[model samples]
Target: MMNSREIIAKRVAKFFKAGDLVNLGIGMPTIVANYLPAEAKVMLHSENGFIGLGPTPAEGEEEKDVVNAGAAPVTIVPGGACFDSAMSFALIRGGHLAATVLGALEVDEKGNLANWMVPGKMVPGMGGAMDLVAGARKVIIAMEHTTKEGNPKILKSCSLPLTAANEVDYIVTELGVMEITPEGIALRELASGVTLEEIQAKTEANLIIPDKIDIME
Candidate 1:
């Protein structure tokens, strides 16, 4: 059986159609590659300066120089090539990316996203995320339904520092799929064995459940 992380990524992949130029965030979002259709033709872009990346290389088959922005070893597809970071940011800043899958620390009802820093925690800094969110044609978030401490990540408002304001388009977690709409957060789908009651109980935000919700298979 797939774990919750794998399950979330698998569900999120369905939103990435062929021909999309996608940038995958480092953590849970990275697993989406493993779940994409083998026949689908999608271009993977890395903010660190590569496009047309294939997928994570198998163990022992890694190329030390080939890595994504997250520094994870990856394989390049046939047409993939590396460029400098300036060119990479140029693509992102120019809004050339069709879609971007991201991992979130917290997403508020108003679609505000907070992922870069936690108070008193150490991190290098927020990299290209601000540009990615600003420029990507559409943003898709993949993350857990709740934090390890059982705190809801989908909230009425983020308590942490925000990475961006009012940009999140869609959210996919282990328990459900939600869309950020002008009205509020709309619960679009629920994973198998998850209940609307459970989602509402765990979430700190007001979840709008449509009359018809897609039950994830």
Candidate 2:
């Protein structure tokens, strides 16, 4: 059985297709790159200023300068390019990306996201999350099902400051995959060995579970 993080990453990776320009946000979202199918031919964008980002480099093979937006050493695929922040924001704000996978602290039934800062904790700033969620053609959230204290991160309404209003399209977690729709949050698939009752207990939002829910691959 795969661990929780790997389960989420593997499930989230299925959303991308060939030729898609995707931005994998820091944290859990970055793991999606490792699970992407080799033939997908997806191009990764880093907000700090690079594209064609590859998976994490082996420990001994780390490049001194090549890194993702998270400042973690990474590999650049062949034909990848590096540029200034101006160009990076231009590409993002221009809505050229097919999708952007991000991690979130809270996601409400209305698809509102709040992930940047937790009130008392000092943070550098909101970073590119604001632009990424609003600018990306599709915003996919990759995060755990619950907080460390066993609190539901998916709620009927977000308590934290929102990163974007009604912008999230999909939410992928260790327990299941959910899609925000006009009606509400739809439970599309459940991870193997997890039950509907288990998911509902961990989710504060009312899930629209279909009769024929599929198991996550």
Candidate 3:
């Protein structure tokens, strides 16, 4: 059976296409870069001002200025280009990005995202998520099925602060892949070892399981 990280990687890989421009958010979202198809050329856009990005830099070889939007150090591809942060947002806000993979705290039935601050806990600022959700052609969220204590992240309504409304199109969890529609999360696919009833039982929100189940093997 695939672990949580591997499951996220597999789900991300399925979304790849040739000549697509994509942005990967912090943490699990950043892992998508390592799984992208080698044969298919996908241009990676970093909100910190680099396009055509590569993987994370080696240990002890970190560059202070060369980092991702999350401030984590990164390595660039041979043909990579760097620009100002303002100019980078221009590309994202101008709708040049085809898709974005973001990590979220909570995703409601209406496809709203809440990833920024956790209120009293003082989490990371909203950052570029606002623009990414509103501008990207498609926004996919890559996260675990539940919280550290096993509470579901997919909910009927988000408890944390929202980043955007009705923005998320797809969501990948260890349990399954849920396609967010105007009404709610449509159960389009499930992991190879998981079942629709199992996922629904684990999830805290109402799930719309489609008649046809696309099992991701």
lDDT per residue for candidate 1 within 1-217, as digits (tens), equals 9999999888888887787888989888888998889777878898888998876788999998998787778889997878998999888878888888898889999889988888788565789888898888888888988999998999999988888899899998888899999999999999889888999998999999889999874
Q: Model 3 off-target regions past 4 Å?
A: 57-64
* Colliding pairs, model 2: none
For model 2, give the RMSD to the true fold.
1.5
Cα-based lDDT at residue 45, candidate 3: 95
Q: List the residue pairs that clash in candidate 1.
A: none
- Residue-wise C-alpha lDDT for candidate 3, range 60-109, written one tens digit per residue: 99989887777778788866789998989998989899899998889988
**Please, what are the lDDT tens digits per residue for candidate 2 over residues 1-217?**
6888998999889998999999988888888988999999999998888888987788899988898887889888986889999999888989999999999999999999999988888565789999999999999999989999999999999998889999999999988899999999999999888999999999999999888899988
Q: How does each model score on TM-score?
A: 0.94, 0.94, 0.92
Model 1 RMSD in angstroms: 1.5
- The TM-score between candidate 2 and the true structure equals 0.94
lDDT (C-alpha) at residue 64 in model 3? 92
Candidate order by lDDT, highest to lowest? 2, 1, 3
Which of candidates 2 and 3 is the stronger one according to TM-score?
2
Quick one: best lDDT, which candidate? 2
lDDT of 3: 0.85
